[model samples]
Target: MKHLYTILFLLTGLLSATVSQTRPDKINVILMGSTHFGQEGFYKQGPSMDLFSPGRQKEIADINKQLAQYRPDMILIEREPSEQHTVDSLYNLYTSGKLQFAQLSYGRAEQYQFGYTLAKQLNLPQVYGVDFYSSLPTRLMRDGKNLDKFIEDLNKFSNLGRSFDQQLKDGQLSLKQYLLKLNAPETLQATYYNIYINPARVTDGSFGKADKTVDTARIDKSHIGAEYISLFYNRELKIYSNLLSLQQAHQSKRILLIMGQRHAAVLSKILEDNPDFNLVPLSSYLK
Candidate 1:
């Protein structure tokens, strides 16, 4: 009986230890969008705010402070995995308090203005690069055909950007408010629908020839715009794959993702369907 009692005690201890090692809860991901540093790519124009201006710099500083409260275990950015070395080398300089920004990396120059500030403030590990690049298989503007129409439709969609800029000018929305709005559920939905999915309907005249699907709509040979849409969707998938790899490798409990506003909606949709993540709204932290 003494031996039996000792064995039971050891078994109980093993069970308790096993329970303690159970996997953590879903990761809380905050996907935020940013305007680039050069402002060249923003609607073929420049950023509304002057990044170097003292007033604008102060605004960015305050926004980074608020975001640091999320306490993310990992931060992801719009960069390529191959550039990880550059990201690490640059991040090291900022964390050591040696400098304010790193010259390496690309895309909208957010690393200096937005990323470095958040990483330093939170004392986070170096940001991960998850951007994937590829050429579009189908161009919206063909040599002749609906090329002119493409411009008209594209401009109509670009109006969304102008509308957002006007809101900022009116002072009805602060910088943080505008940033949060970029990723709001409804806003993302509208952006994707109007920007990608809707324009894809333009039937680049290859509906039957290019479409992966075989339907009466494509029974007649036409330049289906689906091919172009696929390029957009495929690129996002590759980027998301990089992020997934990082999450698993680090066993991250939370991730703060920063990317272009155009990408926020598509990425949010992908993450929304994944059971492993709890898509925390920007409002939770922005407010």
Candidate 2:
């Protein structure tokens, strides 16, 4: 009888492990590209511009149609984790019908801010932000006071130059085109690597003991291609880690992530490396 009891316990442990390893129903993700809903140039926009332009409204409707079909268990956004309170407040305002604007302003702040509202409307779980925000002190440390001043000055200049609608439209530019327009040379790649890796080491006070044998010289190029590539790679790793955690926590539920278009390629590549995840692009539903 004791021997039989031991056998039963072993079988139970094995069954639990098997259940943990099993995949959920289906995880669907969408990497959406915004176009300011066909708004004008970027330099002239104000805070009061329409949030959901007509084109954007149609897009959201179409996406909603997809959501209804997919019926995902959760929706995740690309917002900073620290902005949860602001997002929650905005969502409340939206669902309460207190947030109103033109019909065509669907992609505006008011519109983008409606992500939580949409999640609620779909009757899905609360939306989550998968990224972290840098604190003010950290930002100041990473970027000098001059850099902060420059960003402030740039924002002021931009606001004075163009309509808010235009600014939204500008954000729609593809990653490649945007980088090229910035005139970032290949050499900037090394600079970015140093910035990213050195900070962690410095902050941890482990710079003296960290591995310095690997030569990053070859990867540092002037077109800044390496930097761009690294950024995307890091982003993919972050998403993968989060998805893995979500998978472990909710063994039976599906998770849907909404991110920018630039991340699609890198994420697709990363997914290819992990056989457990079956990734389905949003484009598949459009047809």
Candidate 3:
């Protein structure tokens, strides 16, 4: 009888393990990278697109129509995690029709246009704020003209991105083609890594004792460049962490996250790392 009981216990343990492995806790995640509108002064530049224009609004409506088929259970917006309560209140007001979406200023690009609209269309209960804000001090390790050079390099990169977008607007490339091109490793290096990351390492004196002339820019530890890069990733990590914090409660559900276009690569990588969460391709919905 004792042996029989032991065998039953062993079988139960195996069954439990199997259940844990096979449970439908795997979440379906779709991440959308969008350019913000109506915040020109914040970027110290002109708007990327006129989201409020009739043509743009019609385009956005069409995009939302495509996105609605995913029928996500929750939508995440580009809002500071600390502002969750405020977002909750706003969402409730919007749902209750007490507040018009047009009156909302914060996260108007993401929350109003994409998130709230998606939520309302799907009858979702809530919208999530998953963004993390952190500013890490960056300085030139070598005191020289490097500071001015770095600023100039950053401005150049901004212009490059604008030019790339203009090409799309001019019908030189389809939206999918543009996104595919932008997400390419070469393109990421040309746009993001070259300007924001590489310049700092080259000028920060933390290029380490290695050959500073190395053309391929990569992150090295214990340097100012490394410091800036860490903060950049740290924010993404925090955003993913915030997403995970909400996952168990919304398991086996479809979630859509809206964030800045520049962050899509890092956030996509982070979400893809989770064994249980399947990161859905943006291409699938863009069609």
Model 3 lDDT, residue 147, Cα: 51
Tell me the tens digit of each residue's lDDT in model 3 across 111-213: 6877887788888888988887654333323333255666566677678767767776666754455555655555545545643566554433443232332
The alpha-carbon lDDT assigned to residue 203 of candidate 2 equals 24
lDDT of 2 by residue, 208-250 (tens): 1112332335433332323323443555577667666656666
Better of 1 and 3 by lDDT: 1
Tens digits of per-residue lDDT for model 1, 1-287:
99999999999999866433232577778888765654544423434444554655777888777777778778888779999998888788767877553243342266567776787777776788888865443343343345456656567656766677667655666667777776677778876875567545555354323334333253322444554566578788988899899998999887888888777888888987998877777676676
Error of 1 at 73 (Å): 0.9
lDDT for residue 198 in candidate 3, whole number 0-100: 64
Stretch of 10 with least lDDT, candidate 2: 202-211
Better of 1 and 2 by lDDT: 1
CA lDDT of each prediction against the hidden true structure: 0.68, 0.45, 0.66
Best candidate according to TM-score: 1
lDDT of 2: 0.45
